[model samples]
Target chain A: MGTITVEKANELFWLGRYAERVYTTLREFFIGFDRMIEAEEAYIEYCKIVDVPNVYESKREFLEKYPFDTENPDSILSNLYRAYDNALVLRDEIHTETLSYIQLSIYDMKKARVSIAPLIEMQKVIDNLLAFWGSVDDKVDEEKTRSIIKLGRRVERIDLYLRFRMSCDKLKTEKNKLEKRIVRTGLKYDESKLCELSSMIDSGEILLNQAIALIESLVEV
Target chain B: MEQLYKQSEVVNDLLARYGVKFGIYKNGNFKEQLFPFDAIPRVITKEEFNYLERGLSQRVRALNCFLKDIYAEKKIVKDGVLPEEFLYASSGYLAECESIMPPKGIYSHISGIDLVQSKDGTWYVLEDNLRVPSGASYPMIARELCRRSSPGTFMENKVCDNRNYASLLKQVMDYSNTGGINVIMTPGRYNAAYFEHSYLAEKTGSVLVCGSDLFVEGDHLYYRDYTGKKIQVGAVYRRISDEYLDPMTFKEESVIGVPNIMKVYKKGNVALINAPGNGIADDKGIYYFVPKMIQYYLGEESVLNNASTYLPFYQKDMEYVLENFDKLVIKDVAEAGGYGVVFGSSFTKEKKEDFIELLKREPRRFIAQEVIDFIDIDIMEGDQQVPRKADLRAFVLTGEDTYVWKSGLTRFSRNPDSFIVNSSQGGGFKDTWVLSQ
Candidate 1:
């Protein structure tokens, strides 16, 4: 089992990505939906943040089609589904109850209805998902695997902050977790290069080359 | 507030946390779904359970005798209680298990007897599952969760503590084991009863194994550990059917079966819990003859009652089945888990005629049962309580001794009108309480 078939390794990688995708996206969407409630033509600002078209005929359509829709692979519901599916096959590798919590949370999320109830109640779902992800970080036997998942979580956090134009303070916390996760995963990078990229993003002027350099530095390892 | 009787949201909450669940396949993807929990315990008084225990054990004891007779002496056939052709033609009859007596000479070490109580409180045995049956773990765990959710509920009532299921299971496996480790072999995480398999393994302290974890080398079955270490396996409570057991012996291409394990088994290096060829004992066709086997072999009258079964193999029984085709429940001898069962009353006239024609052509394939007016159990439908059809799967363990776990899994259909109580059919399960009194 430790031979780690390439397919299972890929599943592990995707499981990390998908779990983070659902988690970060839901948090981002909730914030935008709140802001759009008071802004002029709420869809424009929200769409700008999420990097999607505000093209729905109305705000109602956008709300209906977003968050929990499975038909949309980009939706929170679909991503969680994929995460759980991946975790299902990896039960022998991870803690059983850890996988169970992921499945339980996703199952509960799938039943969310189209009401204002989702807006207020979505936080509990987020907390459960975060708890599920946290349990994996805490309970996984291989600290390297936890580091890898945190890598995925950090990357997704970066994606959310860059895409949603969130305050840097929020991104800062995620970045710190990601940095701590990196220590355990054993990824190498030049300190000077990371400083340069952070400053560029802070100045709202992300250099694709510098970012690519940082990402490639880890991969080439 | 008092917990509502019947199926309720309250009970479902308890079931989910304890991992009371079943597996299903949708769009070719395997998923484990929580079987809905009905809050109402299918309450059986101490006296009633005693009667059931007597009958079920009697029925199983007879089945064991018949299994031995069919595999060895064929005395039942010679004695004219059973026909040779009937035993030979049976799909459950396995030539591989010929003349092989399991450890302790026990076959059907664990029996899952399905029963339905009628309005009059009389219970009728619907079928016998001598092969691996699930749901025992569901109610066992559910009871723990429920008692914690409401301590007073059990205090005010007399209910049997079914938590000893794991101990009973352990004893059965240990008694039947040749000498090594007790392993619960599961197909994988996707099999419909994976939860039960894993849960039982944890509770019984048996190692949970997949097909890949086992291999036969030099006529011995061995379990491969994570670090490439191999340990001899003394006993295996295989959850998979006998057909997929040793691919080399049965289905050669089965990726889920261990190769050459039969060689080890035949050499008596390890013991298979419930043993192979159990289909012969649990087969629906063989069910009709249990009472006869009891009388012929055990020298005792049947303690439990069947559902008035009419096997089509006999010309006289076939005629009777044809005449009552619209009133009887026809079951395919090979089907289990409520599959291949058809209620005559539910069929169209043309369908009934078609079934009759099929029965006439292959009389050995079916047995028609007179439908009893079985009582309905209540389940929660949102906030309202509704009556739904349900059945109990009671686990009786035969070790160096015979014992029954007090708790049994009670499965009920989610649909109010459906008689099917299979988890694969979207049914939910409840914890059964056999009162300690």
Candidate 2:
């Protein structure tokens, strides 16, 4: 690399974050959407949770359009496309096969409406993308580039929170010297132990049961 | 009966298998989108290819001479062929590069020369992309996959093999090396053309690096590995633009640029591909004078003819552009990638008047050219094979010798009615097949 222009650095960080966010959020949305099925005023409740306007006229509309509509321009599919585009530009920084995983995932994400099977058909894409991220982590060695990528994921996670207004549920956000920023998803944890917890969290480790217990501890507040 | 459509299915499948794509910003969000490949090969006959090779070579050499002179002696300006005001006023003109020489003293090591053929069969120069031009890998990779899809297509045709492009690029980098490893420097992943950056690096066996991987210490460029081993970079085929090449020298606040890399490049410790300050020679206004530069420098007539162009910097050309605003295309000198190109026919009468007044006020910002009704190539859309307007971007590598890649990138408009086929404009590309015969 000759020089990292400020514009490129911003793109690199976003590419990593958006790719990860798309993988994680898509997984989270599937779970969150499933839960809304039995809730009161389900569609409206979920809309408020995601913080997006309740544009859908019905539950069916939300299911079909919430994630796939290109017109929304901020849909799950759209964000994934954005992530992949950034990844495409940053291909040299990340592994080739890793990028291929993201490419296959977005390709699969676009056809979310076509499958007669279920959202389960997309599990492969999700798994492949997760593996891709892990490979990228193992392969890319430069700190400046890697830190910027991590920073990208951090920013994306923060934005995903702000966009969906998802109850500050995924990670722990704190006030930094200049602004509110993310540190991690727990209440003080070891960095070396994070890989294990992150994998668990990705596999639905921190769920409503965990949410309830954490809330039980803070009920007085 | 429908070979092009069949080719696309094959190309698309290959793209999926090997992976080739880029990013685009739509609705304020970035998206990684596959650069849809059309299977129909843009075929150029051996005679036409020879003509193009000669013209493009001449144009490149003349531009090279222009760069050498602009920085060293300003001979063309002294000869009264090119105006001094145009050089100083245009955005592509960089005075900072004056008196500074790059490795091997070749300004444009790789030139992505865009060209279009008219319905009547005349070729016109569309633009000269001398600044970190891309699309080489797009065709290079697409060809590899396309051949896998239809092996018979190659066996039956006389198409020129474009597989030597990477070797040519490698040779160019090696030829200019000051003494260390060759590195392919990409801005990072997420750049619009990041796939090409990495793919080319892999193909050429050069180490891929991001800006942060490189730093200049006391006029020596180094790529620091994660293990803290500093590898000296003798040459860098950087894919970033000149404005972002150095923060300390140009945009001090730019975080992606190295602080003192320019100092090191100037010190001659490292070779920069498509060196900075080269934009002056490729400027739209300067483009018109390339043929003249060839005649003056090499004492030979230009092998290529530029699309009939008018520089409003001259009174006569300004009058013609004003009168023919409805028939010509206006271009902003500083704008690139189809961003600044405006077609006269597409503008409303009111808009045409506004543009005329704008051109009068800032003629330096614009140049006008005759619209080349470029030829169309077939692309498969569903079951039908349709002809869409397309142009060719020929890649010429300059090292020990000037060699045009046997094949070039054939980008076509995906929009049914559009003429612009740049990746930035949502244009997908096809592979160009040049027959050896």
Candidate 3:
């Protein structure tokens, strides 16, 4: 692989973050969606957990708009579009085959928006996302490129896990993974913040807002 | 062939999946649209390919010679073969590039020569795209997907592989490199040919960069890596136009342009592929003088024929254009990509008079050509075969030698009544196949 410019490195980092954001949120939406089928206003709690505004008024509105609305920047479709935007520019770094999976994911997201049975199409979106990551690992030969994206993926996954209030074991596993991955990326980060997050994770008591803030600012492009 | 045609949708789906798209600005809004692909390949026989190979190489070589001479001595203009007015009035001609020879004395390294075949089977050169010619990636990628769709179709036929466009491109850059690395510079992802730029960079193993990623220091163009280490760039295949390449040299207001890069180029510290000031060679007005340029420079008759073109700047040609106003197509020399083009026959009487007045006032700004009835190729429209006008854009790569890629881009108008086949004008493309047998 040739030299990676600062601009391309920034794009690679965001591509990883956005792809993981779509994948994790889609999964969370699925779980909340099932709960909504039995209890109409379950999406209210779902919004609070995901830290997005409760813009939808009714169960039908949430079901129809939360996953598909492009105007809402927090929607699954919007995040998927962001992932596509980042991946589109990183074609040389990620390779075309890996980039195609993101393109395919966007297509599936669009198809899901109109379908009566949208889960089938959304499932395909998740499958393509998985394939995108797998292709990145298999085809992206540049160790730094792979590590940067992996760093982004690790950061985003831990952020989402903290938001969902997952178990202490889950947090430690992801936190450890992030600590190992960040060093390999060759990107500059605030080491003190990462150490602070480690202490928080090790203490078995985490402040949600402070931890998410630390993770967001840990890496510098 | 039938097998390939039947799998058109599958192939198209793959194109979309891979984001094989071109961006266009519609009403000041940028939209990336899928360039529709017709599965039926445009096959050229080995004999025909060989003929085109010779003619295209000859034409590109002459154009390169013309570029070298026009900037150095203006010999052709002095010898009365080409008028000085055409050279000076051309918007493509840059005074900044005068007398500064490129690294290899090569201009127009990768030329996209557009051609159309008449119904009578004679091919006519339509235009020469010397500066930033694109669409090679469309056919190259399409060929890959076509083979994937119908491997049996390819196995049964003897088609020359066109997948070596990257290596050919690499050779062009490598041969032109002064010392260090090769990079493909793009304006941004929003540009129409961004897909080609990035894909070619990936294929050629060159770093893809934008203007902000590069800087000039001590008479050298350097690419700054993420680590803040500066790597010297010996050659840059810049996809942006000349005017937007160096803000200090061309368009000072252009934020996308690298400052002082032209200073590096002028000093022979770096090479710019297809070199700046190349637009002067491919100017629509200069295109009328290419055959004469071939004779004047090479002392040989042009191997290819240009369309019957007339410059209204000349008295005799002006009279001929005025007399046959309805039979010619008028084009603005400054415009491109199907814009500023008017079919004379389509004009009303009042519009014709108004245009004639404008033509007489700015005769040097326009050229007239006899509208040839080009041959049509069948394209699939909902399982039905329909004929549409098409033109071929053949790529010629000049490195140690001038090479014509065996395959070309065959673009056809989607509209039944239209002659314009620009992707921006809603045209579809077919993969051009050069038959080995």
Best by lDDT: 3
Number of the candidate with higher TM-score, 1 or 3: 3
Query: Predictions ranked by TM-score, top down?
Result: 3, 1, 2
lDDT for B21 (candidate 2): 69
DockQ values, each candidate: 0.11, 0.12, 0.82
Worst 10 residues of 1 chain B by lDDT: B1-10
> In candidate 2, what are the lDDT values of residues A47-158, reduced to their tens digit?
7765668888878778778878778865777778787777765555565666777777866776666775447756766886777768667866655665566655554554
Score chain B of candidate 2 by TM-score.
0.97
lDDT of 1 by residue, A7-121 (tens): 3444565677778777778877777677767764786667766666555777777777767767776677778888877776655445555676676666467555544567655
Tens-digit lDDT track for model 2 on B371-402? 88788888888878788999999998898788
Give the TM-score of chain A, superposed on the true chain A, for all candidates in the order listed. 0.77, 0.69, 0.98
Which whole-number lDDT from 0 to 100 does residue A183 have in model 1?
61
TM-score of each prediction: 0.78, 0.74, 0.99
Most accurate candidate by TM-score: 3
- Tens-place lDDT per residue, model 3, B169-204, is 999999999988999999999999899988888889
Q: State the lDDT of candidate 1 residue by residue for B1-437, as single tens digits.
A: 15434325556665664455677888988766777766677888888889888887777777877787677888898988887777888778899989887777888888999989888977888888888877787777777767776777888888888898888888888888888888888898778888778677766767777788788889778876433457888899999988899888898778888898777887877888878888887888888888888888779998877889998888889889877778888899878777899988888878877877888888888889998888998766667667888888888888886676676889888876788988888888888988878
